[model samples]
Target: MELIERIRLHAARSPDSTALEWPGGTIGYAGLAAEIERLAAELRGRGISTLAISLGNGPAWAMLDLAALHAGLCLVPLPPFFSEGQMRHALKLSGAQALVTDQAVVLRERLDLPEPMGSWRVAGRPLSWIDLPGDPQAVPAGVRKLTFTSGTTGEPKGVMLGWNHMEPVVRSLADAAGVTPSDRHLVLTPLSVLLENIAGIYTALWSGATAIVPGCPEVGLIGSSRLDTAAMTLALDRFRATSAIFSPQTLQGLVEAIESGLPRPAAFRFGAVGGAPVPPRLLERAAALELPVYEGYGLSECASVVCLNTPGHNRPGSTGRPLPHVRLRIAADGEVLIAGPGFTGYLGEEPPAGEWWASGDIGRLDPDGFLHLEGRRRNVFITTFGRNLAPEWVEGELTLEPAIAQAALFGEGRPWNTAVVVPAPGADATAVAAAIARSNLNLPDYAQVSRWIAAEGPFTPANGQLTGTGRVRRAAVQGHYQQQIERLYQ
Candidate 1:
């Protein structure tokens, strides 16, 4: 069944219970339903048979999403930080009837964000269900939510999921993550894609938990971009958030709160981190805050998480076992192959014969069955001496130092490993190089970053330093920094 129908069921079951909460906000099941209906009514009338819904992690974003699906329009969710070129490409390919966005890139390119509302506040406005007309025509059977892979290698590939394909993944994730009706979850991802969509909101509600989308003050220095980390602490304290799935970047903020002797979320129990390989130090720091943070592993193809550590089975470096009804196996080449309730296939690509997706990730199963993500398949580089190196391994190690924000390693068909790195603002490049030199001492001689050069500036989505989901785009960085990397060899 669609998430809207499930929401209807819950609203009927618990109309008076709090269904959503954010800092300075709260909504009951009945209130949530009414708002969704109003949102559906408003958009379906505006020739929005298919909506390209653009929203950051927030209440209004969730409300619009559920409402759009309930209103019978196919929805395409955009990652929040897509550059103008990327957004335009995705919007055009999505065949969207209308666009919705708060992304500055969208506005700078004039994608008609504010729409007929004549204001950027429509996403946050409170309109009653009574304000909307009766629901419009329902969506067709193939109607779906479109999620574009972050274009890490090249152009983005849209992954479409029929209403039939998504429900089971939501239930499985909620079960695996151990969310319950008493739990209040702070949504820490943008709403424009399936990764955060199913894992964040749908799964939270499936478990009867409350999900909050922090209200952004306005687009400014102190807006959502800064994220109300301090305010999040207050909300967690007040709402008693028990469980959350977060990007590692947000986990870093929570680490600060813990170090400062601030009150930890009392009900906060289980948390998971994704979007990158988290350092053991980060996880250890999170534990210091009394937050049990597990590193999650998945891609848009896996519908968010194929594996994650839950309450009782916490393991460092491993993204727990697969959820129930999900099947995982290792291919001969070490690729993590999956057959499960998640990710049927890509939009244009033919479904694999067995309904299995070979996660481009190369990983292995420990004897205990927990999975460890090794690195990307394309990342394997053979040095001039035929030494195969996974640059991701070296890079993951280098970025752990607070002074370094980005690192790319290259030695493919070359004499030795060379690195081009971006230092954190105001960091000493010379000292960082010394640290790198020191750190590499522990690594095998062949795998070590034998030489290094400093990057001129941070890598960006525009220039391909980061994927829309915020994971460092390795290929782009390597390509952009080829000259600097070569200089190390010289």
Candidate 2:
């Protein structure tokens, strides 16, 4: 069933069941369905074809998203973490006709809009609605959602998805994770992230579960990468969240918090970890703490999650089997490929060429059919000896040690790999070296980090060294540390 259909069914079956929960209020299934209908009618009356939202995560965000879907308007979700340039690029590229945001004052100054077109209370939160000068750029007829990606470099690209591409993933995910009406899914990452929006919120709603969507600040998410584990855990406990999605970095912080005497949310289960390659050691630690994390793999072009590890079938280091909606295969060159109708293509661009979308990731299916990812196909570097290496594989091992917070290995056409290491807070050289030595134990001599330099600080979006979704921007990091790396080689 479609998302809106599922909401209507839930409202009819269990009108009083909580469908959405936030800091100040809760909306039951009946209220949620009714509210979405009203909002959809309002958007239709205003003649909105494309709607963009920059609101913080909460009931308002949820309601507006559903309203856009119901009203047949293309929804463009702009992540607040995006820079002004990126935000402007998305708004223009997607040809957004209307914008709904809580930070109206700041966005007005940055986006250079005149006074607000109007203001209204949506889902109990006061918000501003502005009319944008729609761009003439064609976004394609079938596109229903345009999600801009915080890719490795350059301006963010808008990946468009239609209802057909998204619904299967939602239903498959709900089935894979075994979501039910009793489950409460906490929205940990930004809803603009397709993974959290489709796989997290949409899946929960499809399963008739309540979605707990506190603002990023309420969950202690300072930006794209920095998180306060204590605050996040408190929210989990407060809402009694049964499920949530996380990137590897956030999961590591939560594990450290639990180790530092903060009680783990006992109700927490089905933690889906992705957005980057997860260190096996980190997964082991989380498992040791009984955190119930499952690693998955996806790309925005594939409609968020292509494959996921579920409770019934999971492998620790592998990214798991493909979900039912799509078929996955390894190309002759070892690139992962997904077969389906694919996306509606990037905004203002021609439709994607092939029937199979090249994932750019290199991985293989195990004997038992589990997909084990090595790293990005383009990211693989060749050493002077002509041996190929995937830096993410080595970096994953390095981050396994608690002393090392982030690692970027460089050895392209060089004799040996050199890592720019970001040590955890208060970790001295000795601690970092020890961590590297321990990680080297798990790698072959050819792939070991023969020499390393301490980074000034963690690789983050602010520094242009990390993507919004936590993937390391290898080129940016190498450029920043070129001189130091050369010194180590000399």
Candidate 3:
């Protein structure tokens, strides 16, 4: 539960062993822990007992985050891609005055940042004076990190993750995923998502595995300096990476790596996917390609994972069974409800106006006892043809390939589904569409994507298409492609 203690233990046990990796590079436990202590001392002189981090996936970002904990400052990760509009909203909402960010443009263009300390820039320029001082100390028992629930109606609600909330969940996953001290596991998702924090960081480091952060922007998200196929392959090769956690989107990159003749490390042993429902087709291709991908499910409230399919216990379409300590129930309406370690709902919000948490997701368990997630209650749509549909069902099937990076299917009052997709960087539109067509062969006519369009670019969070948790804003997606949808139908 003590942040500094965990790092100290890792540092003492294997001072020379690599503890974590980022796009800018790797850090040995001794060095990282030392830096945390040094950074803590620097922060202490500034009289700041709290920190708000606004960086992305890399060594610097992770260092700032973990160092803040060791420094005993209440930590808050400012989702790096929030628009000025959203940033101001979050700032006002959280009352965070000090921030550490990687955005040069925001500083140069906006002209509104706290007083500059020394000199700083993201991509280049200068940010608010960058001199701060603090000493690393054990965080007291209370709120540690404030993670937000992506907006449902309007302003996002902040969820306070008490210091101990993630320790158990991270440990459970490390146990379930078979993480070991010698392994080097790639950290893929953005920091805003709990998956990367719990499964990617805590679990990997807890098991004494080297948590590798890609040094490039492409390896993790659209523009991440720490991630890319080549970087991932090189890191896996260079570090002898043993495992990873990915979303379906991230797995698509793995498919590309295979196709590009990027060698999959024989040491690579485990991988699991979630964030959204993963199609069976995607799993099949991942398996065939030797990526060892397994599908799973979780939410931010659960601190990342509750149920996951592991190597030998794999189920293709299901999210798989819950971890031993998690209990699950399917409400009469078919929504999945869970009670387990690691979960605490939004801090300021009342639990649905009363007691038990009602996940807005609708799902059911098969008679065979495996869990099957249906669509989100807010997302199910009835078509113009009077056919009710789960858009994610069709969209998930389309994203099974190495080409489709993102997809959205909507046609609430239309005869059939209309999909708007973003293809992988260089994939041809016609070819990608054909692949989707081929994948849809088994779906009923009503459920099939009757028309589809591909965009040349992927959506960015700044444009408001993605949430901090990396979920698509379906309405924003639909609105962005409105004219294109009309063109497809006509």
Per-residue lDDT, model 3, residue 7, is 67
Which of the two, 1 or 2, has more TM-score? 2
lDDT of 2 by residue, 265-289 (tens): 9898789999999989889998999
The root-mean-square deviation over C-alpha atoms between each candidate and the true structure, in angstroms, is 4.4, 1.5, 4.4
lDDT tens readout by residue for model 3, 1-490: 5656776788898887888765455678888788777767766666665566666566666666676666666776766566666666555555554666666446535636655555444222243433223332322336567666664335666665665677777767877888878888877667766678768877776777788775335453455212366665555566666787776666766776776888876788888888877778777777788777788888777666878888867777888888875778888877788776544445445533433456678888777667888788888888877887887788777777557777788888888887888886678878787877876796888888777788646656666776654567788887778888888778
Per-residue CA lDDT of candidate 1, range 306-333, in tens? 7888777768878887777678899999
Candidate 3 residue runs with Cα over 4 Å from true position: 22-27, 102-105, 119-141, 150-153, 218-228, 341-348, 351-355, 367-369, 384-386, 401-405, 423-433, 453-457, 468-470, 483-490
Give the clashing residue pairs of candidate 2, or none. none
Top candidate by TM-score:
2
For model 3 the local lDDT of residue 401 reads 55
Model 1's C-alpha root-mean-square deviation from the true structure amounts to 4.4
In terms of lDDT, the best-performing candidate is 2
lDDT: the better of candidates 1 and 2: 2
What C-alpha lDDT does candidate 3 achieve relative to the native structure? 0.69
